[model samples]
Target: MGAGLSGLACAITLEKHGISPAVFEVRERLGDRFVNAESMLSILQKPITDPVAFFAEKNGIYLKPTASIQRLLVFSQSQKAEIEGSLGFINYRGRHEHAFERQLGRQVKSAIQYRSKATYEELLMEYTHVVVATGDGEYTRKMHNFRTDLTVSLKGAMVTGDFDRYTPCAWLDYSYMEKGYGYLLPLSDTEANLVMAYPDYPENDRLDVDERWGLFYERVCRDLRQPLRITSHFHVTGYPIGICRRARIGNTFFVGNCFGALMPFLGFGQFTALLTGIYAAYDICGKGAYEELTQPLRRSYENSLVLRRAVERLDNEDLDRIVPVLGSRWGESILQGKSFNALRWLAFALRPWMTKR
Candidate 1:
C-alpha cells in the first residue's frame, strides 16, 4: 500500500505479468519516502550465486546497483582487521533514493497513485489481490497479527571525509555497543555515513539517541585514530527485527519489512524485499506460493541468528579473534552462502520458529 522499493517493484512485476496493479503511496514526491526517511545506506552480503541477475532476467525487471563494496575494515576496541573479499553492495537510503526511485519510477509510473492513503480493507474490497509492503511499522502487527521478537534504535549521520569508499569499516567493540556494532560507510571520499546501532534499552528514553550515538562514536574515533567531521543532520529510527512467523494471511500477503524480511542481527532487507516483491506478483498470478518463496531466506537468517547472538556475548578480546576469522576461508564460506556450523562454538541462539507463507 506504499510506494517504497518493494511496492513499486511489485507494481512493475504485476504489470509485466499482464496484471494491472495500482500502487498507492502516502508521499507527494516519488522519492520523498527515502529523502525524509532513514539516512543510513544498507550493506548486503552477496549470495554465492547471482540471485538478482537470475530473477531480473527471468521477470524482465531491472535491479541496478548504485555502489559496490569490495572489502571491509573491521575493528574492536583494541584490534582492527581488514577483510579482503567481496563484502557486498550498498543501495543508499535518504536522498540517494531520489535517483533510485526515479529509475524505478520510469518503469512503473503508470501504476502508482501518489498521495493516496490506501488501506487493506479498501484494496481488498476493490481488487482480487492485496500485497502489503509498507515496511517495518505497527500497522503490519495490527493488521496481520504478526509478531515482533525485538527492535533496535539506529542513529545515523553523514560526515565529510576523504576515505576509501570500497572498504567499508565496522566496529564490534562490546564496551561501546554491546548488542550492536558501529560502521562508517563512504559513498565517496568527500561523503560518508557514521552509524551506531544497538538494542533499544530503557536507558535510551532518559538519554538522547544522538548523545548516546556520540558517546559510542567518540570511542570509535579515539580507538581507530580517525578525525571525522560530522556535516549533516542526524537521523534516527528503528525497525522491528528478528525472525517473522508468517508472510501471508489469507488474501493479504506481507512483503518487505511488513513480512519481517529484515535480518535481526545485521539489518539487511533490500535484497529480501525486492525478491519478495516479485514473488508477491508471482503469487498473485498463481505462479508461485509467497510463503514457499520466502522460506529459504528465513532459514538462512535463522541460521545466522547463531552468529548474531554470539557477537552479543563477545568482548574486545573475542571481537579481536573474530574479525580475523571473518576474513578466513571458513568465514568467507559462510558469508558466501555455504553451510557452516556456527553453533559448534558453544553458542546458542534463538531457534527458528515455524514460518507460514
Candidate 2:
C-alpha cells in the first residue's frame, strides 16, 4: 500500500506478470526523508557473496551500491580490532537520486498516488487483495499480530570527513551507552553517516541522548584522528524492533518491516524487505506461496533475536574480550568462509547464553 522499497518492488514484479496494481504513499515523493547511508553485509546474507548481482540475476531486481566494504574496524572500551576481507557493500538511503527507494520507484510503470490517506479498512472494501507495506508495524500491531522484542533510540548525522569509502567502523562502550553501539558508514570519500543506537528500556529512560552523542562523537574523532563537521542529523526514539506472528491474514499480505523482515541484532533488512515484496507478487500471480517464500526470512529474524538477547546481557568487559576474537584468524575464517552458515552457528552457540541470562 506504500511506495517505499517493498511496495515499489511489489508493483514492478506484478507489472512483469501482466498485473497492474495501484500503489499509494503518504509522502509526496519517493525517498522523502532524511538522507543517510546503510550497509548490506555479505556475511549477514550468507551464500550470497554479491547481493547486488544476486538480486539482479536471481530475482530480476537490479540495484547499485555506493561502495564495496572491504574492511571493518571495531573498538570496544579497552580493545580495538580490525578485519579485512570482501565484507559487503554500502548503499545510500532516503531522499537522493541513488537512494534505494528512488531506484525502485523509477522501475514502476503505474502511477503512484502520493499523499495517500487511504486506510486499510477502506482499501479492503474495494480491492480483492491488500498488501500492507506501510514501512512499520503499527497496522500489524493493531491486528494483534506483532511481538515487539525491543525499542531503540537512534541518533545519527551526515558529516563531512576524510573517510575510506571501503571501510566501516563500529564502537562498543558502556561509558557512553549501555548495551548500545556506534557506527560510521561512508557515503563517499568526503562524507559519511555517523550513528549511535541504544535500547530505550526503563533502565535507560533517564539517559540524555545529546550527552551520549557528545561522548560518542568525541571518541570517534579521537579514534579517527580527524574532526568531522555535521551536515545534517536525525534522532529517532522508541522505534520498535519486532516481528509479526502471521505473514498473511485472509487476502491481506504483509511485506517489508510489516512482515518482520528487520533483524533485531543489527537492524538490517533491505534485502529481505525487497524479497518479501517480490514474494507477495508471486503469490498474487499464483507462482508461489507467500508463507512458504518468507519462511527462511522469518527464521533468520528469530535467529538474530538470539544474538540480540545475548548482546543485551553483555557488559563492557565482555565486549572487550569478544572484539579481539572478531579480529582473530578464526573469526576471519568464519566470516570469509562459504562452507557453512556462520551466523546460524554463532546464533546456535549463543542461544544457551541468551537463555541463561
Candidate 3:
C-alpha cells in the first residue's frame, strides 16, 4: 500500500512477473523525513558480497549507495576496541528519495497516488491482494495482538568534526546507556551523524530527549576523545520495534518494519524489508514462498532478541568482557551472518535470569 523501499520493491517484483501494480504513499515524496543513514551488509558472508549487486543479479532490482563504512570503533561501557572491517554500505536517508527508492522509482513507472491515505478496509475493498508496506504497521499490531515491543529512542544531529569518512564509532554501555548504544557515522570530513538508540529503560523515564541526546553526544566525544560539536539536532523519534505474529492476514501481507523485519539486536531492517517484500510478491503470484524464503531471517531476528535480553542484564564488568569478543574474528563472523556461537550466546541470554530486579 505504501511506496517506501519495501512497497516499491513489492511493486517492482510484481512488475517483473508481468503484473501491473498500483502504489500508494502517505508522504508526498518517498524516503523524505525518515532521517538516518543505514548500513547494508552483504547477503553473502565470505568475500563480502555487495547487497545491491546480489539483489541486481538475483532479482533484476538494484540499489545505489551514498557511502561505504570501512572501519568500526566499538566501545564497551568503558573499554574501547577498534577493528578494520566493512561495517556496511551507508546510504543517506535524507528528507527526500534515498538511494534505493530513487533508483527503484525510476525503473518502475507506477502511478503512485501521492498524499493518498487509504485504510486497510479501503484497500481490501478494491484490490484483490493488499501488500501493507506502511513501514510501521499500527493496524496489523492491533489485529494480531502482538505483545513484544522495544523502544528505539533515536536522536540525530549534524556535527562539525575532523573525522575519517570511513571510520565511525559504535558505543555500547549498559551503565549510562542501559539497554541502548550510540553511533557516529561520518558522511564527510566536516559533517557526521550522531545517533543513539536503546531499548526502553526506566532510568531515562524522566529526562527529556534533548537532555538525553546531549549526554549521549558528550559520552561519544569522551570515549573517542573527539571534541566534535553539534551544529544542530533533530527531534527524537522513539518508535517501537516488535515481531509480528504473522505478516499475512487473509489476502493482505505486511513487510518492512511493520512486520518487525528489523534486526532485534541493533534494529537494522532494510535487508529484511527488501527480502520480505520480494517474498510477498512471490506469494501474490501463487508461489507462497514468503515464509520459506524468510525463515532464516526470522530465526536471526529471534536470536537477536535473546542477545538484547542478555545485554539488558549485563553490568559494567560484563560489558567490558563482551567488548573484546565483539572485536574478535568470532564476532566478525557473527556480524557477517556467518555463524553463531550457540553456547556463548546462550550464556549471555541466560545471564540476565541469574539476577532478579
Candidate 4:
C-alpha cells in the first residue's frame, strides 16, 4: 500500500519475474512519508551489486566506495565525541519521493495508482490479492492483529547548514538518549546533517523549528569551539516512532513498519525500508504464479518479529555503548564487509515488508 523504496523494489522485482503488481501510496507524493534535511543514503556498493549498479548506471549516479566518509561524532546535550573512518557516502538530492516512482513508474506505470486511497474491503475486491506496505500506522495494526507495543519512542531531527569545514568525512554525535545518538553526516562542504534519536517518543505537536534552531546551532558551535551562524531555517517536524511485533496476517501481510521496524539506534530505518522492499518482491515471486502467497510471507514475518525484539533489547540495553564503540577502536575491530551480526542480516532479509508486490 506504499510506493516508497520497498514498494518500488517490489514492482521491479515482480516485473523481472513476469508478474505485474499494483502500488498504492497514501501520501500525495511518493517519498512524503519521511523527511531529511542533509543526509547520505550510504550504499556500500562496489561496482557490481545489482541495486548499486542499477542506480549508478541508470542515473549517472557515481559513488566513491573507498571510505571517503570519515569522522564519526556522537553528542548529548552535555557530552560529545568524534572518530575517524573511511566509510563511503552517497549524496542524493531532489524530490526523492518521486525519484524511485519515476523509475518504477516507467516499468509499471499502468500498475501504479498515485494520489489514491482504498479501504481494505474495497482493495480486496479490486485486486486478486492484497499486500499492505503502508508503513507504521493505525490501519496496519488493526488489519494484522499482531501483538505490538508502541511504548519505546524515538525522535529524528535533521538540519542542514554550513559547518567550519573541519571535517572531510561523516561525523556521528551519539551522546544523547543515554541510549541514543545524533548524526552529523556531511552531504558536502556547504551542507551538514544533524539527525538525532532519543528514547522518548517525539511530541506530536509540530516543532517550532526556528525557536529550537538555536539549540542545534549552539551545539555545533560549542562542539567545534567556533562561532556559528544560521543563515536560513529550512524545515522541521516530528513524528511518532514505534516497533511492531507481527509482520504478516492471513493474506494481508505487513511489510515495512507494518510488520516491524528497526530501532532508531543508528538511523537505519531507510536502509530497513529498502531491504524490506527487496524481500517483498522475493516472497511474492516465491508464491505460485496464481496461488495464495501468505505462507512465505508468514515465515518471513516471524523471522522479522524475532529480529525486531532483539534490536529493541539492544536499544533498551546498550545503544549508548554502540555509538561509543563505533567511535572506538573496539568497534573498528569488529565491523566487517557486509557482515554484521545476525540482526543486520535479518534487516536485509525483511526489506520487502514496505513494498507491495
Query: C-alpha displacement of 30 in model 3, angstroms?
Result: 1.0
Residue 24 in model 1: lDDT: 83
Q: Please, what is the TM-score per model? A: 0.85, 0.97, 0.88, 0.64
Q: Pick the candidate with the highest TM-score.
A: 2
Residue 284, model 3, lDDT: 89
Q: Backbone clash tally for model 1?
A: 1
lDDT of 2 by residue, 239-348 (tens): 88888898999999999989987899888888888889999999999999999989989889989999888788789999999999999999998888976789888898
- Alpha-carbon RMSD, each predicted model: 4.3, 1.2, 3.3, 7.8
Q: Which segments of candidate 3 are over 4 A away from where they belong?
A: 42-49, 223-225, 329-357
Per-residue lDDT tens digits for candidate 4, residues 3-31, read 75556655666676778787787667555
Tens digits of per-residue lDDT for model 1 on 277-319? 8888889988999889988777756655555665565677877
List the lowest-lDDT window of 10 residues for candidate 4. 40-49
Better of 1 and 3 by TM-score: 3
Query: Residue 347: error of model 3 in Å?
Result: 8.9
Give lDDT tens digits, candidate 3, residues 221-330: 87767788877666555577787777677888878877667776677788778878888999988767676766766666776676666667677788799889867887
Better of 1 and 2 by TM-score: 2
